[model samples]
Target chain A: MSAAAVLAVVVGAAAAKGELTGDPKAGEAIYARCFACHALAYNRTGPKHCGLLGRRAGSVAGFEYSAAMKRANWVWNRQTLDRFLADPLKAVPGTTMGYAGVKDRQERADLIAYIEQAGRSEVCRAR
Target chain B: MSSRIQSPDASLSLASDAPNLETRRSFLGKSGLVLSGAAVALLAGRDVLAKGNRPAGSDVNVLNSALGAELEAIAAYQVGAESGLLQKPVLNLAVTFQGHHKEHADVLTKTIIKLGGQPVSAKEKYTFPVETLKTQSDVLRFAAMLEKGAVSAYLGAVPVFENRDLAKAAASILGDEAMHWAILRNALGDAPVPAAFMS
Candidate 1:
């Protein structure tokens, strides 16, 4: 089989397992891909996610906001987040999220799950 | 383009997916990812023994993710080494770079334990591109991309650490990865330093 095929199968299998709410722990692992830009409570290259649930996109304090992010009107929630993550470049042109967004729905689901939990963690609260 | 290159880590696999290994390694080998060894150990779902410690703040998560990237970098270098696409001179350089990644992984793993965090053990297989490499230049380009990503990833990692010590280490490694990226770019006849600032 092709490498793309293998990836599709592997990724598809991973997503299929998530079902609906997705797996936060598994999503945490997927969040590794985001570590290059984001952190749980504080901002890095990207804005922090400590209170990302209802937070406006690109509104984190202190972190310099990308013009695109700052201009975005969308709020972060499951539906909007799913669309953004499905394709950050398309969802928000001029966005610097960089990587091809997580292609697998389940992976995204899981990742969002973890981000939500971490956003609510003591560390985030402390921040 | 050494499409005939072989994977170095086929022998290191603990899994039964011999066929999967061939196709997967073949793709990486040809596409310039040339990964093996450490990838097999983790991607095959075997435990690598992170050992326990008194975990601290979110630093553990950050460190484990950083470690994961290092492991991928290590696999990429190994992929290049066993691919036979690299000439001895380039291969030696790649080996040196691989050693650096291994060192990074070691420190991250140990530090993760010291922070009371479990280091990442199992990894899902990466999606390496296929048949895109038709020359040594192709491999070099791919390797350079990975190095560049490593440099950028470290940029974020350095700040996320709660302990200033780990941040220092991350910054140090970031310099090394940047150096590697620059050298690879030079080898590709591109500007070693292509930008005024990374981000």
Candidate 2:
């Protein structure tokens, strides 16, 4: 089957399971794209996502945020994350983060899963 | 042509969509008070954390400049949307983008007031590249250029804030502006994101 078909099947099954279906292991590989600018422990090119799931936009300590982001009311959630990952610019227009964002839905889902898992780990929690 | 290029008072009447007078006044009053409080705090040798470690009155200037840029973007999108050059879909998109700029302007105004500075009022007129927006392609290209400049503007300003909070705010705005540029570039048939590093 084509990649698209496989993705559809996976997504459908995940939806049927009534939960997010991305594998954190798979997500770790997908995270390589983000690892350049983001880290679990501290702010870099972008702010750290160590505790990102519920944080408001521009709330990270010591990170330089754009005016648009500082004033944004968005809170991180699965849906918001998906929207942002799908198209960072479209999700938030004035943001300075250089990455275009993950285009593939499965990749984004996996990436989010990895972030969630890694963020809660003792390594991230200790920071 | 030179007159048009340099004229800061050219009629780009978008007053209906712009923030109202009362709102501007309220913002100015609030921001002024906040700055006064910060100044008092400084004199008392207390560090005002909310003001971001910058000098008492400085944040107003930074925020006003940002507000001015947002107004410029609003004007640019207004002109493009009214130019009759874009198809329906494109026109709709332009309007939506305009709304986003308006939101940015509103937020900046509020932030300025909260930080004790008056929000910059919309210009009486603006000098847009009206002559160049004669075609659909020209219009999109112009919008993209404006978005690109906005991204750079925010990026430059973000790091200057002594307050990490303000820095984070500026970074957030930068992200949105970058997004706008990416979308416009995509509309112009360029890659949505051309490089790993946006700088």
Candidate 3:
């Protein structure tokens, strides 16, 4: 990730966590695994992660989501994302994302920070 | 991985003893007890009908059907645990998976009721091919086959939901069912993560 992106994520992380810390740079590295199926702007094997925060589950238009995901009523935020990042199946039950999940809490937090910051880009915003 | 070809169809049929599934030459069967794929057919019935295709039944039908399957799964686990054929570890795992099914059933029941639809009741008796449970391997294989069908059934129903929330609920169950399949398949000496796209 670029230095500016890292800075933004760090700042955002501080605000979201209220004195807790996360490394966006490290999170970006962690997010590499997710990149195989997801992109910032375009949907691939998984839905695009851009603007993922605050969006309701399975609400992405044009994406084929599972019935369970389409029915999920919760909004995506830092806390929800953290739990989901730690264990997708446990968090969402029937989500189709095939990855087992990032088990490390710190790693998950970092990934969330990176994703949140990435969502802010003009490219992501355009979606 | 074992030489057994993963037969998603015969295993998911749940109709008969599933002779094809029996003939697959699974390592589980070779190890000790043989598995009958008939149990998985439980989900193959109208329980999986998507709302889009048959709006008359809609979400209530799908939820009720799923509840029935979950109750069956719970009963299956109860039978397996009581049969004494499973190893202690395997038995514990079965119990845990059964709990997950119970959770699914609870959610389905509540959702159905919330929709002003009556929830389906658990069967007083289910006729699983219990005679096939000759060993721990048999129990795991049987459970694994059932989990695979659950994954397929939920995934198939996901796109059909008129209600997005129900769709999301199905997706959540699909993820757990997939996890259960992976673990059980691994125990049966098969490559757990065999595909990029889940069937």
Candidate 4:
């Protein structure tokens, strides 16, 4: 094969592998869907969803949670959140979040990425 | 120029066979010509007609409606913040809700603009149910109702939006509203997921 053709093949492979470059802008738009239920700050609504990426489920302060959620024992890491968002009922049965999990893989990834980024901010961590 | 040819007046003879048939055929023929003439007129005035008859798609209408609701909610929160009826924690919650409402308004406005509709600006004056809200509990009650209505509207509109991205956006907002509802319910000392909401 020619050198140019070989280089093109290598670049194409890299591009395919990098297809999931989650756009935070697009992710921010996607996060609007999440704002209905979870606040990025701590306070009165359900649980404060700030800093949720590495935090365990049902661990936010000042929110009274269901017994099932409290005992679920799962953390909100990317993989775990992906699985839970894919199938919330299946991921942790008896939990109260009634959303039919996001079926689109790209949307789930974008949502997770946004949450992770938002969770890292000082406002998110203040609570 | 070529000689102008006169078409046969078929209706004259046809009128004798069946009186109504002649009327029907004549009506249809004349109507067809009128319609054709109107089409020509429209084509000539295409820009004017296009400006007048914007596509009234349901998604666009719903987004506009949602934007209006968000504006109302924002106004409500601002009032609640200034009323001094709420303590520090409740006041902070109202601020949070106001921020979310602003976000919702911004997104819905963008959606309307994207779909070729003009977004309505948020008004400073709002008519809220807070006239009767004399205490912190009363304020919380009103907030709960507002959040519940927002959740219902988002959920109801989700199915009507044909665009997958718009539907996703609606669902995202619906989830947040649901969370807000839960929080408000908790504040009101009710169950997070009320029986009515679950059903």
Candidates in order, interface RMSD in Å: 10.4, 13.7, 14.2, 11.9
How well is each residue in B1-199 modelled by candidate 3, as lDDT tens digits? 1111111211122223334334543555687663222222223222444332332345665666567667767777777666778775666677667766766777777666656567867644454556667899998987887777677567656665666556766787878888998999898899997788764
DockQ of each: 0.04, 0.02, 0.01, 0.02
Please give the range of 10 consecutive residues that has the lowest summed lDDT in model 1 chain B: B40-49
lDDT of 2 by residue, B1-199 (tens): 2013221232325334334434754796788743332233233222344435534454555556667767767766877776789886677667667766776777777667666666767655555647657788899887877677666556656554545556566677678778887988888899988777643
Docking class of predicted structure 3: incorrect
Question: What are the clashing pairs of model 1?
Answer: B1-B134, B1-B135, B34-B79, B35-B79, B53-B116, B54-B116, B55-B115, B55-B116
- Local distance difference test, each candidate: 0.65, 0.66, 0.66, 0.62
lDDT by residue for model 1 over A26-99, one digit each (tens)? Answer: 98766755644455654444577788888899777676554777898989986678889877756886565533
Location of the lowest summed lDDT over 10 successive residues in candidate 4 chain A: A36-45
Winning candidate number (TM-score):
1
| lDDT tens digits, residue span A3-51, model 2 | 9999999789769865467778999866654532455675544687889
DockQ agreement of candidate 1 with the native complex: 0.04
- Of 1 and 4, the candidate ranking higher by lDDT: 1
Worst 10 residues of 1 chain A by lDDT: A36-45
Error of 4 at B50 (Å): 21
Show model 1 residue runs off by greater than 4 Å.
Answer: A1-127, B1-55, B122-125
Question: What proportion of the real contacts between chains A and B does each prediction keep?
Answer: 0.03, 0.00, 0.00, 0.00
Off by over 4 Å in 2: A1-127, B2-55
